[model samples]
Target: MRRVADHLDIPELERRFRTCPDAVEARHVQVIWLLAQGHTVGATSEVTAFGTRWIEQLLERYNASGPDALANGRRRNGLKPSLLTAEVLEVVRLRLADPPPDGGLWSSRKVADVIAAHLGLERVLPQRGWEALKALGWSLQRPRPRNPKSATAEEAQAFKKLADAVAEEAAAHPGVAVEVFCTDEHRLGLKPVLRSVWAPKGQRPTALGHHRFLWLYVTAFVGPATGETVWYLTDTVSKPLFADLLDAFAKAIGAGPDKRVVLLLDNAGWHTLPNLVVPAGLRLVYLPPYSPELQPAETLWTLVDEPIVNTFVPNLDRLINTITERCTNLTTRQPEISSRTNFAWWPANRVPS
Candidate 1:
């Protein structure tokens, strides 16, 4: 017989056993891995720091009932299973499984309400309600804006043509001869995010005792070929600040667009205004009206907003520094942005046949 250590395969064993809900639940799988390593149950238990009795019980149970039983038990003993057991989970599944009351898709709140009502819960306290649903893997999320102002067919085509032009031109240039920067601005509040909690059906939910609103603006640039990003953070996004941000972005890609620098930017008033000033090395191309998807930088901002800037920073200085540090770290980790080439400019009437 192969010795336990000789055949154990620790990495593979870890992968299999770690899938269990927790260390306690995974003990059986741990024993299996150890036993396969050629150790007796007592020895396996000793090495695993698990009790021999428990390991033996698991082994015996596995032999009698098989692998599935070892993972998910068929029964819970004694008390009757509450209707609320799968509780909000059933609510989500049923709602999604069928159409809503208005014969439309089920809304988040309605799903919450149905689950609470079905469990015969009078209050379905918001705190415990969200927790329960989350435990069952139900998350309340909102849809994002899509199909931006490409408000008109002509405008959408115009933006598409611009993006394709830049892409094609970069193909014509070789080895860092050109770079593309898809740029955009994101604004965030410095207040702690409001979290939904449970309360009695008719009772008002609790509110934060002290909360203040602050603002942050971020400018992000993305490289299209590789998904790399560079971001700048500021408190106020003024015209001059915008110009400064543009200069910084130009240096970021090693400037001198004589090599051709294409900037995929939005049609925000600042970008289009004839009065606004910017650096000479960079050239701007507009995204289709109402269209934000073409700008890869938006995806970068989503990551920043969701993970890095999700909560309030203490003060302006700390927030600014923190934002810069985080942006640098993210940019380092995602190095593909350096390769992004600018959009090639073409006349509005041009369309690829």
Candidate 2:
């Protein structure tokens, strides 16, 4: 048993342990506090969940420097010299701009090989390669899938045009409360939607699934600027149904000569203007073909599916009820919705006339 010096009395040590703001410092204080109470080093290790060797080192520091030494020392020590030099990092950055030699995605091993080749070494550790990537502020990310038919230049031009059109509408009806909204439909069914979740190292979590073709459609109208959403649940989607939804939505938002609305949506078959009954003061703007990514309402589907993902629904009614509840809750979370859907290029609310 190593004696804890009388630098801090037991009650003072207890107070420091309790009031310490830093978690690591609090833990170190706890070890010293326990030892001051006559607990052996092995006993203090068991209590703090710290190794005995670590407790011994901590005791040495505390006895020598008093309570001030309990703070985490690792943070004060600056980072060690990186293996990735400036020249090497530039080479890695340039190489990353193109596909790897194998015409596949770049990996740590490939980056290590690149580094090794540059340094004229036989090989470099993959761990060092990973560190190099971090030093360059690169992260592993799943790429967003894009439709090959979608034209980037066309999307940019279309967005600019839409912004202009919205501005024009606001200008035409000045001070009439013109609101920009994006609407989309999502299909949910009895089929399970599986997603990865954290579990213990060797244990895998399971979700019960019963795949069925029975479906329900959730139509959402979301304002990108304010995140105000109007949701309608229906069993089917058609021109007539969509028209009715438009009428209901118009009534809900009080869209008319007093308040104009510019609604953006995709070029779906049911969303066409022909034979479609668009309500008064509601102008429909179609997004460029094959560009669902441009639709703000498209971002709401993930939020709408949270309740039912990786879980089994016995029937359509249960699924509908679950989704309905989720949608109702989402209506209150405007800030979250706005943050997710408000793309930088999307026009701001209340555009100057």
Question: Which is the leading candidate under lDDT?
Answer: 2
Off by over 4 Å in 2: 1-83, 196-203, 343-353
Q: Give a tens-digit lDDT track for model 1, residues 1-353.
A: 32333233667666769886755557667787767666787788677787878777766665566555456343354333344466456655666667767787555455556766776776554444454455567666788656643556565555555556566556554443555557889876556544455668998655332245677888887765555676777777777778878888777776563455677788887777676666755667777677765565665654464433325456656656766776777777554443333223422211123
Judged by TM-score, which candidate is best?
A: 2
Off by over 4 Å in 1: 1-158, 167-176, 194-210, 306-312, 335-353
Minimum summed lDDT over a 10-residue window in model 2 is located at 74-83
Please provide, for model 2 over 187-241, each residue's C-alpha lDDT reduced to its tens digit, 9 standing for 90 to 100: 9899889888788999988899988899899999988888889999999999999
Model 1, poorest ten-residue lDDT window?
342-351
Candidate 1, residue 2: the lDDT equals 27
